[model samples]
Target: MNKMYKVLATASILALAAMPVAANAQQLPAQAVQKGNANKQTDVKNVPATWGQITNFVHDKSDKFITVTGRGLAPTDQDEIVLAITPKTKFIDAKGKTVPLQKIIDGHKTVKAFYSPNITKSIPARGTALTLVVQDQSFSAIDGKVTEVRDGRILVKGTDVYDKHDEEIWLHFADKATIIDQNRKTIAAGDIKEGMSVRAFYGPAVAMSLPPQSGTNYVIVNTNMEDVNPGEVNELTAGTAGVITDQKDGQITVIGQPLEKGGVNYVVLSIDDKTQIVDEDGNKLTKDALKTSGHVEATYGAVMTLMYPAHTHADKIVVKKAESVKIEGTVMPSDRTSKDQVYVNVGSDDSTANDVILNISKETTIIPALGGDTALRAGTKIVAFHSPVMTKSLPGITSAEVVIVTSDKDAVQPK
Candidate 1:
């Protein structure tokens, strides 16, 4: 019996060795197992992150989600996915500062998201977002002529080299939008005017309006006007008409028609003893006759300052008499033959139907209550001075001698 037991035990041991050695029995050491387990945990923690542009936001009472584009698990995977936002999710900006989720959405910023490897088996996989890093704001530049300068916006008409097309864009100035001269010196939005060349940096998102619109980041006014050759003689015959914007201590600044065709919208005229100040009838007048908001025609010499609104000695200045008719009303929307004109509703409301079409020519003076010339657009309240002799039509058409912007309600409001 003892011999049988020994044989049986040997047989058992032989069978165990001959049979598959239950893999675990020949397993690696505890340290190796621990290392393996640690590696797996590390893998779970180090799942590859996917980056994409935030296309849209989805929010409700109990949940928040964001749609991300240009990201996928594989190279051939769909480019968009829906990411769930949890309380533990963190939002970081390019500056490494923590920001609210709304800020990223409002900025329409791109982001990199860290999420779990597990995702829904949907066309565009849905996953829980662990963290999101907001990318820096990317800016695009548009350089062109300023077609219009409204309360807090400007229309730029020029060629877009990237798009390879001519575009007119209305750029809305943000509260922090910087306006600088060619020298990088800070300037005011009012300093910008139609007909001047400018370069503006703005965001990628553009509003689909009549002329595309975008929020401007910064603007650099091209103060470098084409220099006149010394050899070329300037015909002292250049003439301009507009309203006197500034007059003090024998110096007058006029905002009106370009000194020459296709020139700047303003000019600085230096008055001296030889300068002739007169009225339309050629009656002599003192230098005091040149007043702010007074419509006038000016003739200047060829020699002028290099700066825009070129400064020069005035050979003659004709201050026209004040318009006899005065109309106070809100600027209304109407079909216009030119961008230089606006339709004014004669009363406090549009119900009056008494629309007066004010043609804004180079001679019209636009005066903002805050002190500066601005282009007139719809929704502005103004007091327009014009001649009583208007076109005999349902809506009288006349030239606007002076336009006073009484309300700045349409002005830009910072976000």
Candidate 2:
């Protein structure tokens, strides 16, 4: 094998903010009709009406927030009804049409209801419909009951509602009330629309399940797609000729060139097909030769299955190409000596790259064949994928999926 080794990055892109649009506004009827009159209609009295309805249920999570738009109403004048309805509940719309409370929200405009974690809130109960008189100029109307007040949130449940204007109705709330609403909200099925924002409590249940927390956080790249190309490694003529210390099935261990002046032995393995390599005689070597010493390359990609030992140790490397991709970057010292493990510096300046400590060993090499390799350096210009590394306090995200860098002709360095 030859003594020419450079760090090839597998580029990929990741954007967690890529979420589904919430809801579209409800379309108004093409032909405008009279509200409660067929022929020459008489004006209805505008007296302050006190309508009542039930709150079926409320649901929520910590990370996601709900948005509630004000409907020109206040918390006091509006009557808050508490009621929990089941799939069998019946609802009546303004047209006196009977419908299931769970089938609304069909083509109705709905908006997100934002809430402060400190402020616990209640939403219409699931499968239930509620109605209240519109009063004041506030967009929101909350019925404050003094029975079970905790964290300043109201709870309601049971019963049906009456006197709700379809176009003028916009009630959005989350279910993470600091205090659970033993009483739920109620609703009439005919009034629900596809565009209406809802929680676990609303009629047309629009709830998405969340994946479990897997503790382990690492960079993943599909071996089939393009590799993550970090910037270029300047000072191409500064390092000593590298020597192969160990080589095995698709794995290489090289220790010779000093990363710094007197750095420790640096040994790593290229597991996938995206990892590339070349020998001292300018002979192309398979990624398997990485265990021996040579040139190599890597690419980036979107979502992939990441398997690690004990959810902490980087024992194996696996990349599954799906759709999105980005470049990943990490600055680890070659001084640290460890088998199938390396410390990465999250402080790297690669915009499209994500920095993460990586470990690749048995579980990775055990796989068949995937990804390739091409000669790359710390700063070698290359495309990459940028994803997010979630933490307890903050979130870490990359700029781009893959950082486009120079080609192979521009990546190779002097011996």
Candidate 3:
């Protein structure tokens, strides 16, 4: 029975190789199939040839093999063919250049393999590879901001031609991967930083994972921040000041007052080696300084995910000092003792309610919700950063350091 099965399998492989182009037209590239057939006729001389995408490659000290699927065959595990590589196997690249085996495996390019006619009856038949030709060596480009940089890898968040949505991809740099700056000068991988704009060139083969993984070939850093006009928003700039709600897994969750009436109120800031974490006194600190319920001002890249509580790569994070506290609530009607004084209700429930009066002095920084200076009024939502110490009066009062108007209903247009 085994001998009969081998004969049948051999006959099936031969018939499929000789079959018309229409049978495997979609699976194999036209140029690859034509060249494969020509090689069978001239070089191999009656040896059967099969072409497909390299699904798996195994290379050790002296053992090397590749699994492929195509040539009128289904892509199922049972239909894959394992081709063993030996010293006699010739490797040819897309440009007809004679290349090494490592180059073909590194690119993970689709290939046409000429093999011996004798076949085994194993689930996935095995054979000796004669000549392998790389079908495509075309490179793909990804333009985005670097979110993370690790040992020999960098995570980029951006879009490609095939995917319009935001994609976070981890690019594994090949040993020979070239890194260059804007002037085209070669640089080390250490120069790549979080929030920096870069374009990476990689191969088509991608490993299936949550965030897809690919082998990168070349990288170009776009480092020209001085050219941007002051106050102009671009792909390289984004800022938010809010309270830290969570800090874990190298990310900080900041819950700030909404930018507009119904805008986003939270942002996830991803930190990397280049992210500067400091205190308001200009003293440098580690990421551990970002504690929950603490106020912070973060500057990150404009490239961010569109999901709720958007995520971005942070460039700098300024942690508010321990002496300060942030209060967020609705403004309440109260008779002010002076023009710089305002009152706010500090809690939703009656049991926790506290009427706090904020003294906005000339030294206070008032930022309006809609981008310009606007006076705070009743029923307005505000986030005020002030000293924790307050006067022990009916309505607790303190000097406001920074008051952000978060409501638009009472916001007046700036002149």
Score every model by TM-score.
0.32, 0.15, 0.32
What's every prediction's RMSD, in angstroms?
A: 27.2, 28.2, 23.5
For model 2, give the 10-residue run with minimal summed lDDT: 211-220
How does candidate 2 score on lDDT?
0.25
Candidate 3: stretches off by over 4 Å: 1-267, 272-288, 293-299, 305-310, 316-323, 348-353, 361-375, 381-384, 401-415
- Tens-place lDDT per residue, model 1, 13-90, is 212212211111111111223364545632223443444456667678977877665333233233455677888877
Stretches of candidate 2 exceeding 4 Å from the true structure? 1-248, 251-276, 279-283, 287-289, 292-297, 300-303, 309-415
The Cα RMSD of model 1 versus the native structure comes to 27.2
Candidate 3 per-residue lDDT over residues 1-415, each given as its tens digit: 0001011232232232122221223232123333645456433134456554555677778678876643312222122456777788778865668877777667655566766555432224556776777775333446778988987688887765222455677777666556767666778888888888886755445544546666674676866533355556533455767667668999987755432212234578889889988989889999778887687878776556533346778878889865456778877666654678888777633533376888877656555542223467776788777768898886788987666667747533346
* Local lDDT at 278 for model 3: 91
Q: How far off is model 2, as Cα RMSD?
A: 28.2
Better of 1 and 3 by lDDT: 1
Residue-level lDDT of model 2, residues 112-224, one tens digit each, is: 11111111011110112222212111111222111221232112211112212121111222222111111223333222333222221221221121110001011011112
Find the 10 residues in a row with the least total lDDT in model 1. Answer: 21-30
Which has the higher TM-score value, candidate number 2 or candidate number 3?
A: 3
